[model samples]
Target: MKRNFLLLLIFVLVVIAISEGIGFQSIPIGKFNIGLLPLVFAIIITMVLGIRIFRKGIIKKIYSKENVNFASKYLIFIMLPLMARYGADVAPKLKEILSIGWVFLIQEVGNLGTVVLGLPIALLIGLRREAIGATLGIGREGELAYISEKYTLESPEGRGVLSLYIIGTLFGAIFFSIFAPVLLDLGFRVEALAMASGVGSGSMMTAASSTLVARMPELGETIRAYASASQLLTSFLGTFTMVFLAAPLQKFMYGLFIRGEK
Candidate 1:
């Protein structure tokens, strides 16, 4: 154990303290507003501090293996309360979600859009077989597990998924927080966007819906309920998409990308 655990704790406290101090600011440009949330800055600042460009120093010691692993291990536990609160939002609007229940299920097929849309981009950018893992449904926990088990982490596919997973972990929330509000400003419907926010990831859903709530406080509970329900369905359906849809699409595209098959 480190001699001064409080130093790390105090550093995080100060970062959050300063982040909250800035709060949420909306910058105006023409007719649209650019929103800045404190959590956005907090994430950026923490990521910058943890960057290994410094190599060895107090930053390295502060972000020790023990400390980092502890945070990683307990992140799910920390989100439990937030998930419970979102669950409450869903209960009141259960009937609304039920009305569109078929829409959500049908949209589960849309998960294959990942392979459809991204495989070509990945190949055009000069990725090899690694494109199989990278474009196979957002590179989240389930995709990683499936890739690792089917292909093993020692393979190139494993490396591809891991690389995308790390990137998603770092910036997905930031992108969602900004992207959701911008889309609404561009005249998208809140309910549709809320349902789409549930793109199979809890943190991303929360980030997107929070912006929606900030912009439309009157519909905050409804947004949360829609987002929470969508996220549950996306997560549940993603596995089937991966096995049935993603695999075949990847095979066909890989042949086109690598084998020049007609």
Candidate 2:
């Protein structure tokens, strides 16, 4: 386990080194600036290395099964301090966040939009029990924890959430990197986009805010503060929103769908 941890740390450090070396870059498309942060590169590089193309070759040794399990167990600890830092981003914008207090609180109800809209689509696509997990939310850390606690990680619901969790982790940041800029291009306010960028996932928030900052350098600090503040609120509220609202609502919808099919 010690050796596996060391290997994981070494690989992470190497990736960080490479990303910092590349720094930040962007492209101009008329009024829009497509920012390219080192984050996108690191995700691509890490994913490419872990792909099946290298599975039977060199990376097999680098990402041994033991090391994979070891790393997963400790990944939470690694994210703890980083989440705190994200929360700290709210300090400078404390007044702003307080003024928009009702917005943050009301927006939490929107979290259930995933399950409300996704359940029927999921069922139509032949997803049964799994629909409960996948549609509960974006399947981030909060949903994963909720599903695992209520149904255990080995349950059908657990598989549903885990599937989305993996997909979100891998591609959500990239999606936000592109999506935020597109929204900005479409004439959305930077402040609005920044708040929306807080999808309750740290990586995705960073990607979304980075792109906005890189494009509108004058609003960089404001963008970060708004994004981090929104993220902090959503993440904190997302869990309760899930347990109290999404869960019961999913049950009702799933029951309704089952009856209709019958």
TM-scores for candidates 1 onward, in order: 0.91, 0.90
Q: Indicate the worst ten consecutive residues by lDDT in candidate 1.
A: 1-10
State candidate 1's TM-score.
Answer: 0.91
Name the regions of candidate 1 deviating beyond 4 angstroms. Answer: 2-7, 53-57, 260-262
Which parts of model 2 are misplaced by more than 4 Å? 27-33, 56-58, 260-262
Candidate 1 lDDT by residue in tens digits, 189-242: 999889989888777888888878888899998999999888877878888888
Model 1: residue 180 alpha-carbon error in angstroms: 1.0
Model 2: how far residue 168 lies from native, Å: 1.1
lDDT of candidate model 1 versus the reference = 0.84
Stretch of 10 with least lDDT, candidate 2: 53-62
Error of 2 at 1 (Å): 4.3
lDDT of 2 by residue, 57-96 (tens): 5467668888777767887887788788776777887897
